[model samples]
Target: MNKRKYEMTSRADAAARTADRIIDAMLARFATTPYENVRIEDVAADAGVTGQTLIRRFGSKAALMNATVARELARVAAAREEAAQASPTDTIHELIHHYERYGALILKTYSEAPLVAGLPALAARGRAFHVDWCRRAFPLDPSLSPTEKAVRTAQIIAICDATTWRILRFDGELDEAQTEQALAALLLPLLV
Candidate 1:
């Protein structure tokens, strides 16, 4: 790569690492405390950065939360891709397993806090990516049309997005395995 390109890539990598640290710290906090109780200063302290530094890097608390949500979704997408390559038919299982691992904080933050209420655009984009992921990850049945596949992908994603997980886990009192079983039930028809 060219010098300027290399420089930009390195800077981007550094920024991503910093953001990852912040997200990890935030997740640790969210696991024990409610999102409303956690402040930006607390997040900064947990991440080993100054509040000002976090503001400079992530702008506002909303922005930081959005960035963290986006990062987790990206990680999910990456994991899904890797798992899909190995077991296309079982990619939903991999996705559910991944969710069981890193999805708690995401489900809590977006659901309980108003900080992420302003992230509709980001959420929409994430949904679009999810539809594509579902289409690719799930093995296509010979009986399904392309249009049917597209619609089913969108529907499944709409029902099982981050928000859904929060609702199911909190409101419905469904544990991780229950959530996975429900999703697998909905997804199995598509795979067949």
Candidate 2:
């Protein structure tokens, strides 16, 4: 019985690992491809699993996408927590590093949220996460009136948003250091 239990535990562990791989592959695709354009077979190939196995694991494309988004959201939440704990300059560095990694995925999902089922909620959740992150990263005094706090929050969010990063990094052709400087320039003043 002990040997049988050990074998069952090992199989379950392997299955969980395979599921994680499939979700990771789908996330990679979702980062680059439009949600509707992501193919299950391609994801399966990327995960080194058969398409049938993916279907068996996730039941449907939507389920697979949901699992992928959940995993990514958890990752971003943890990163945001760590970034908020850093010093202002370190936070900026952390924010830029995060944007460099997940900016495309965030923007792509937002661009398609209007057209895709289940995306509007995800987009809203992402926005809420950003709002909460900004509040933590740039806290205003409790003595301030609600209106003042609201205005300050908006400025911080706009200054540190991924779109602003794209404008500075891609459109303006700024290097990472310049991009970081620009973000800090816009953000630190508001915090002070």
Candidate 3:
């Protein structure tokens, strides 16, 4: 009986390890490859698992991508929550870092969201996440009217959004530090 239990435990551990490997492989692929271009066979080979195993594990390529995005969102959400405790400038710096880390995957997800079933929901969650972060990172005066608060919140969202990051980093050809400085300059004025 003890031997059987031990065998079951070992099998569970192995399964968990396999799942981790698959997730890691997917995230790595997402870093350098676009969502539409990533092949399941490549992910399976990278994870050291069979393509059939990946299908069995995730059901389909779309499921795999969805799972990958969910995992990344959770990670970013946690980081943002932690950064919320810091000063506003520090939070902006952290936000820029998160964008620099996940910008490519985010852009790909946004572009392919309509085709991917779960991606639109994920994108909505991302927008809410940014809004919540703005609320926490930049507290408004209680005396301000609701409409004014809403407008200011919208501005904060635009300032910290991924599109702004892309324009700064890609179009303006600014490094992360420059991007963070630019965001800080834009955000600090709104707090008044």
How does each model score on lDDT? 0.71, 0.87, 0.87
The local distance difference test score of model 3 is 0.87
Span of 10 residues, lowest total lDDT, candidate 1: 106-115
Q: List the residue pairs that clash in candidate 3.
A: none
lDDT of 3 at 169: 89
TM-score versus the correct structure, for each prediction: 0.66, 0.91, 0.92
Candidate 3 lDDT over residue span 15-133, tens digit each: 98998899889889877887778899999999999999999999988888788888888998998899889988888889899999887677777887787778789888877887888
Task: Give the candidates in order of TM-score, highest first.
Answer: 3, 2, 1
Task: State residue 107's C-alpha deviation in candidate 3, in Å.
Answer: 1.9
Per-residue lDDT over 122-160 for candidate 2, one digit per residue giving the tens place of the 0 to 100 score: 778888999889889888778888998899889999988
Cα lDDT of candidate 2 equals 0.87
lDDT of model 2 at residue 77?
A: 86
RMSD of each: 4.9, 1.8, 1.8
Best-to-worst lDDT order: 2, 3, 1
Model 3 — which ten-residue stretch has the worst lDDT? 104-113
Model 1, residue 178: what's the lDDT? 85
* Candidate 1 per-residue C-alpha lDDT over 85-182 given as tens digits, one digit per residue, 9 for 90 to 100: 76643665677677667666555544564546656666666657766776666646657787986787677676556666656666788877787777
